[model samples]
Target: MEGFDFEKIEKWWVARVKDFFIGKPFKIKMDLSKSVRTLVRGVLSQAERRQKDAGGTAYVGAVMQHLVGAKLELFLDEALEHNGFSVADAPTKRNGDFQIENVVIHVTQTPTESLIQKCVDNLSSNLSPLIVTSHKGAISAENLADAENIADRIDVLEIEQFIATNILEISRFARESRKVTVEQLVEKYNAIIAAHETDPSLSLIIG
Candidate 1:
């Protein structure tokens, strides 16, 4: 520690993230009785509790972002470009969280007026803007869009429902296949977390 340079260590870490190896795969065990949205919210609630315990520094948004990325990759059967949470934190002048074709997808824990403004910008560019957030955030996003007189232009989706509905559709509504679908989701999410986040605590366990 005395001899090592901090700047060199930081540089090494930056390189390490790109080559990070994913270890044992984590699987999501589905609760058959509960709706997919409910299960997804439960996972997020646990993440929120963990965030509160860790001095209240925000990681839930990171979790949501990566989860969305993982879901998209699994659903589309192709990888999506993933950036570290730090890059996501500094979103000034950025178009949206992720862009695919003509759609600009924004993922956030709490939707803000600034985010709505970005959606408006996306519209001006002839791109469809989609806001994916928590159920409460969905309402707030819609309200913000209304204030900007663009409520009908943008699409607002609850994160839980977005992922849950996808899972159901992917599994073809079969109870047995749902567990496997959820497992794939978790596996992809963990891979994204490992490659993008320095903190291993951000990784989701199979439980």
Candidate 2:
């Protein structure tokens, strides 16, 4: 007990009790920046809303699209420099959410017949079609691709898997942890949106 500071310990405990009733001081080593946190929180909020009411599916879907689009853009910029290709948000009228060279990437929370058809259309137009959807949607999407006889021509990818793969690649290239790399990419995304107004095709309107 000679080395112990009993009074300091008591004060700390009292402060903790008060904080429990009111609020703790703002102090956190953020894993993500403010803008990125807001974007992620918005997506999570939409997901929660969807859980409460299936009617929020459309809203959640849109948020997922934007989130995926933004992340893909950052990944492409970092990964494609030596590949002679670049990724960008597709126009509203396009069949894909993103375009990379001759490849068209369609991002969805879930795959549907309509999405499959859009991929087929991309193939018909001589563009390589890549479908990025949730892991739960991958199998069904691939089945739809096979049914349409486009499985050989199109690539179906799981969103989480794709992100993991790219994150590893980025971490390797930067010699950093995957989590840190993700935070860096998000910071880059924030800078991009700040420099140029947030690309409408890559941003969601959550009201």
Root-mean-square deviation of every model: 8.3, 13.0
Best-performing candidate as measured by lDDT: 1
Candidate 1 displacement at residue 180 in angstroms: 0.7
Local distance difference test, each candidate: 0.81, 0.58
User: Model 2 over residues 1-207: C-alpha lDDT tens digits?
Assistant: 899999999988976765453221111133333333343554445454543444332534554454465567667665321110123334336657667889887877678898888887888888999887776789999898899998899898766566656766766744346557666655554444334443332223222
- The top-ranked prediction according to TM-score is 1
lDDT of 1 by residue, 5-107 (tens): 9999998886565334322222343678878887788778767766664556576788888889999998899988888766852455557878888998999
- Would you estimate the TM-scores of all the predictions? 0.82, 0.59
Worst 10 residues of 2 by lDDT: 79-88
lDDT of 2 at 22: 27
